[model samples]
Target: MDKKSELRRDLVSGDWIVISESRSKRKHQFAKKEKRIIVPRSSCPFEDPQRSGNKLPILIYPEIGKWRVQVLENKYPAFKDVKGCAYIFKKGPYSVAEAVGHHDLVLTRDHNKRFDQLPLAEAELVFRAFKDRYEMHLNDPCVSYVSIFHNWGPKAGASIYHPHYQMIAIPVVPPDVEHSLDGSVRFFEKNKKCVHCVMIKEEIKEKNRIVFQNKNAVAFAPFVSKEPFELRIFPKKHIPYFEETSEAVLKDVIKALYFSLKKIAKNMKDPDLNFFIHTAPIKNKKKYHHYHWHIEVIPKTNIDAGFELSTGIEINTVDPDEAAKILKKN
Candidate 1:
């Protein structure tokens, strides 16, 4: 860190991360390894989900022989699907509650092809499965939020090399999401507009950090990026909830995502990455109408050490403008 280091705050979440020019690495240094680990298809659980000791799928497409995509209950779930609401109880000085919710895996038929590699129709089907499962959780009293995310490659926390996405219904809103929701509420109260919509407008005007854009959605590297190659995708219109989004708008968003990931793979040497959706909590839909829903893509280019772990502020090693410039190239 040096004088060139700048502490930039995120407009939507109000979190600060440092862009330290002194700590920046060369562009080539961030490229992924020449060979990514590949798990054998014969041993993949998703190849024959039922034979691998997984329960019956919660939902399946086509509902017949030779499934294209299916959603199954995670064999080992982080949250347990149990009856009754999660109630907090004190254990001496600490308070805890039951982790009652659903964790399911959405798997495509192809074991080798990742989500980004899917055909547009297939990719859209994955999202449709996400929407169906998400809506199923809406009636559960124990569920307060549903997180939809994908972890690509080993470094991005994909223990299984086969391509799959996860949908997790949780008893409470996560702290990071809580911070974002609270910040959105605060901004709307003060400015009388959606914070994310404002950022999207500014990004549209600036154009320097834009990676890809279509008529209804745009993808860009955030000015306050927390890591190298961090990108955010937002619908052009102000949409408060992911589940409520129309098919026409959602298709454009998926298209933008497809192009963005393709650019990253081509330009950044197929780096491992994690992407997750941020939306208003399922518990209070009306309360967060002022909030805008979007997706965040963070490539695993850097790791946290003592400083980042202690202070909770990330040291981004690449300038977002530079990142966008590289990704924007054909």
Candidate 2:
């Protein structure tokens, strides 16, 4: 086989990565992960959800009958249910804020339909709900960043057998996101281009890693993916804010995302995965014109162990080229 390698830049953090083909596994040795053991459908809490003792919906879409999607306060929440600003508590030299942000669970009608299994139309509706609830949380003056994500299996942190997504709005921007936004700003001041758009253009030109593309969006396993089967989806257009995107673009992006997830599931055999959107901050949308919004999907296959945690870096066990080969088959 020919020698292979790829140089990739982080859109938000402006970090360069090298995907070395020397680290790759052989094609015949590419093993598939087993699908997760789901909770029995009978014991599935989401089915006939009301009998399961879930609370009243905070925001309901249809406003009648069994809801497809319902926003509810998390029962055991990391962030307090009471809405309030972060309060600084002094503990010696260190200061910390009260975990006093909003935590909500967005539930869909399906008990068995994983996000990847959903029809594109249903998946788009889930994303629309995400944006809607994000705006609602921002109405509170304390909210700075909202995280929307899905956890597919136990290792990925999903406790229930039923399909659901989560959103947490915090008073402070997450540190990783902070570094990313700072990097984007720095890149803008220097090179004067959205880092994500630059990657998209290059990936489309190469077409080696691109798994799927629609009119408005494209999905690919990143050249420097931190995990085997990691995928990222970006709008072909330079979209600064997710909420600000037109309905047409949003729908297309969701389709691209849904299909990308499906391909991952089919090829990787239902590896537990998590995905979230990374975008500019709520305060300085104008200042982040150089930034672009995209989704990152990380499938949990390897444990971080000592090497990764100590080094503050990840080792991708399956080469991205192999990952793309697996993911592209669907």
Candidate 3:
């Protein structure tokens, strides 16, 4: 079967991913690469953001009358303001589009106290800022999606010694979100049930994969362990958008997130990890009630090798069942 820009189902999860034959990556040989050195804290640009010529912050939080975290435009942004209509330039068959989106960093008062170590209230405050900024960007005509994510430790892509999260709002629906949205739409069309809500119900029944749960949210190891110790936290209700998430649900989510991350921190001896929010596109949210939002945490346990990279399939060294056992024990 051929799909021009249609949704295709996955035999494994019975989910769907958009495969636009007309607009897709043409297979090519791998390019040459080089190793690079990590920047030291002393020379890290974010350590002294102002001195490094970063733009004035759009938002700032203070503690002890000093800067805790500030939301500033990325100094060397992937996206920047351009002339009318965010233009795209082309080089041969390749297309280069202006990253005409917003990239902001959320810094906590501490360069150390990793998110899991922060006071629950402080963590909640960080989330409050996340929601605030997300809403701000949602109104921007240029943005289609806003991604809020945290990279902890070196393994998870944190180049600096400091703990911070990033929010990037862009004009396009990212590939991951594209796949998830398609999945939920197909599920809803077929079963008339939300995919995530169904998964949560099944998880509750199996009593496996569950890491934690409270009145409003649930945390569990995903059925598909793209990487070992991967976890997804979701609101019990079938909320289509993250910005619409209630304050009460946010509090419980933070608790569940804190507990789950703390457990992984203990289990992996503080491995680096990347955690991010996955939700429906901000603009088309009304068309996505079946798209329940969630956070997925993938620990950087193993490096992506040749096969994993070439095929786009991640191989986990440890199994989910075993990972759950170890995390739960910790």
Measured by lDDT, the strongest candidate is 1
lDDT for model 1, on a 0 to 1 scale? 0.90
**In model 2, which runs have C-alpha deviations exceeding 4 angstroms?**
2-32
State each model's CA lDDT, in order.
0.90, 0.79, 0.74
State in Å the error of residue 202, model 1. Answer: 0.3
Flag regions of model 3 displaced more than 4 Å: 1-48, 62-64, 88-96
What ranges in model 1 sit over 4 Å off? 1-4
lDDT tens digits, residue span 222-305, model 2: 876877778999989998888888888888888888888888777777778899998776765587787788898987766776
Candidates by TM-score, descending order: 1, 2, 3
lDDT of model 3 at position 316: 50
The residue-by-residue lDDT of candidate 1 on 137-200, one tens digit each, is 8888789999999999988999998889999999899998999999998999999999999999
Using TM-score, give the best candidate's number.
1
Clashing pairs in 2: none
